[model samples]
Target: EPVEVVVERALAAQAVGIDGVIASGQEAGPIRAATGAGFSIVCPGIRPGGPVGDDQKRTVGVAQAFADGADAIVVGRPIRLASDPQAAARAIQAEIAQALAAR
Candidate 1:
């Protein structure tokens, strides 16, 4: 769904005492715009620039997610499917550190 629709639903949920949601990195911008700091958005399907399977959509990188306004990010495939899972995890953590520092 578009970020606008996501935000609308989030707002509706917030009206009923909800404050957190899982969203795409692409929706981060509109989420921040509409809900500001109060709503928590956890971005999933984060891809770190590699060949991807067709199962995931609306994916974004760690840096882009943070830059656009995702409060948190979930990284899975990049690490799970990597030749060196440990290294991939380290790299992703470093990327997360850098993005957080930039913030």
Candidate 2:
């Protein structure tokens, strides 16, 4: 869900009995919080540094977004734009592992 569509679609999904809602970038945590407990929020446009020439304006690092209560963070360009894509992904994974371990 984009910021413009979150409230309506989130409520719609909830009305339809969907298990969860995936809100992109900025809206994930707030949408999840707004939707109340037990609803999952999958956030896209997640990067360890920042946006990487991608269309996603709203972005945050893995640890920060995870700390903010996103159920999951989606990464695309961060790994795709890396010189060593696998290593970049592994690094991100390691960060996630650390974050999760701390929680």
Candidate 3:
């Protein structure tokens, strides 16, 4: 099936009580629009910078993901490679705080 069609189906499934929907950065907004407001959208492969070491073609950061209506954003390597993992997490938390404040 096409990606859009898959998103629609995923949204429909959530409407009928599926646990949640996994959306890519590009798919997050569209899936959210397709589903009801209450549907949970979980986005993975979120990298802040434009070209990380990984092979993920589509990616967005925590703030952007939240801004795009994602219920949650996942960040992997950025945190792992940080000299201070706690500080990295704190920065992400700060980003979330700013996003929440903006909203």
Q: Say which candidate scores most in lDDT.
A: 1
Q: Which stretches of candidate 2 lie over 4 Å from their true place?
A: 1-5, 51-54
Worst 10 residues of 3 by lDDT: 46-55
Rate residue 63 of model 2 by lDDT. Answer: 74
lDDT of 2 at 34: 69
**Clash list (residue pairs), candidate 1:** none
Give me the runs in candidate 3 sitting further than 4 Å from their true place: 1-3, 49-53
lDDT of 2 at 96: 89
Cα lDDT, model 3, residue 93: 79
lDDT of 3: 0.75
Residue-wise C-alpha lDDT for candidate 3, range 1-103, written one tens digit per residue: 3567768788678768896777776777777777757888888887764346567777776767777778887878778989998998888778878876776
Q: Which residue pairs clash within candidate 2?
A: none
* Candidate 1 ranges beyond 4 A from true positions: 49-54
Candidate models: Cα lDDT each: 0.84, 0.76, 0.75
Task: Write down the lDDT that model 1 would get.
Answer: 0.84
